[model samples]
Target: MTSPYAQQGFRVGFDWGPAGAAAVPGSIVAVVDVLSFTTAVTVAVDLGIDVYPYRWRDETAVAYAEQLDAVLAVGRSQEGITLSPASIRQAQGVRRLVLPSPNGSTISQQLSDSGSTVLAVSLRNTSAAADWVAARLTADPSLTVVAIAAGERWTDGSLRPAVEDLWGAGAFVAGLADRGVGPLSPEARAAAAAYREVAGELPEVLHECAGGRELAAYGFAGDVVVAAEVDISGLVPVLQGSRLSESSKPSRFCPVT
Candidate 1:
């Protein structure tokens, strides 16, 4: 019980738009913009959320909070977004609170600031990334791992808004933490397997997306596809405030290769 088993660590799920899904203090924060920011952050947000297709993100925290139907308290920045008492009603359905993010900026930013160890995840590196995080728990047991999907836009479980980053991220979570791999819940296991089943070229899938296409116009087409793979980075970038930098990198809890 002195190890990961004894710790108060818990697993939770949420959608990461610009305002990333929030993590508990001192938890591990994983960000996946299988479509954009994972690529966009790697490249740079200076491109302004797509120069042409131009992303849509709110200006401030107060305005974003007002958009929700319930008293859903949202936290965000240009980096990522997070929600409290994780629930789907806040995500979709009639009068759904539109997630304010160009890609996963706000959420990305939160993961950076939350003091939680952060890893950029996707369908590409599901095994490797989660292994990287789980190994860390042996030493730091108070792990609060939050898988914030670079979610897609859905209406009545069909279509409305569009994006693919969430798909890739979801698959990674399922592959690594769910399905009995890492003490995950059955619900999480089901979700993970679902994503893994369709896991493929994440970036290409989202290339035609609003933000992805916009990025292409801004001369960042290749970046999207590149960020889709796992273990591609020699450095698993960390989020600090609104910036993705190598300085916050975790101390090799698992092999990057």
Candidate 2:
């Protein structure tokens, strides 16, 4: 019997964080963390850099980077490459980067062993990512795609649903729906509706959302601007093994709904 919590009998699904990702295992999971993590990955992959998502920025992450011969992204306040999409965009000479974040990256790493084909999705690449997933669904109609919004953590380490991530995941969901890719689960439909409601004012909405305001307060408002570049990217960063690289072919432009 299918678990009631799992959005079974649906081609597309939407959920939040690691627990949400685990609920719908073996689906094609798109991890959406638009504020920075996945957005940074999109920018890095667009620049031809391979991204390894690590769960935390610690000694373990440092060792993991060394094992992969990749540079580890530092905290925003620290020097060197950070989670800011702008930082990754301006970075020089680094080909492989281990990006660690509490929300997106942690959920991604948690899903690494769950048999889901993971794609790093953000506002910048939602259309392309949705197109890629749609093509795969065409090839295998049995496949399920779940968009997981990697929300932020509260001061006590609980989930804090971030609207920016909702918009990012919703954008992907909306694109899939536009491509005739559903039978969307109600959660997915809600996400799509959220995106459509704010589609016309995305830039302003993102800039003023809780996540955006937090980043702006930290002087990383430019990163929010980059993340708000909706559908501007054609690169789809698909995870293979532990690293995320561009899909085999460049994605064709597909206008989002």
Measured over all alpha carbons after superposition, the RMSD of each candidate to the real structure, in angstroms, is: 12.9, 5.1
Error of 1 at 69 (Å): 40
For model 2, give the 10-residue run with minimal summed lDDT.
248-257
Candidate 2's residue-wise lDDT over 125-173, tens digit each?
Answer: 9999989999999899889999999999999998999999999999999
What TM-score would each prediction reach against the true structure? Answer: 0.52, 0.95
Candidate 2 residue pairs that clash:
none
lDDT of 1 by residue, 47-66 (tens): 21111111343354344334
Off by over 4 Å in 1: 1-26, 43-101, 111-115, 122-128, 152-163, 178-181, 200-224, 227-230, 247-257
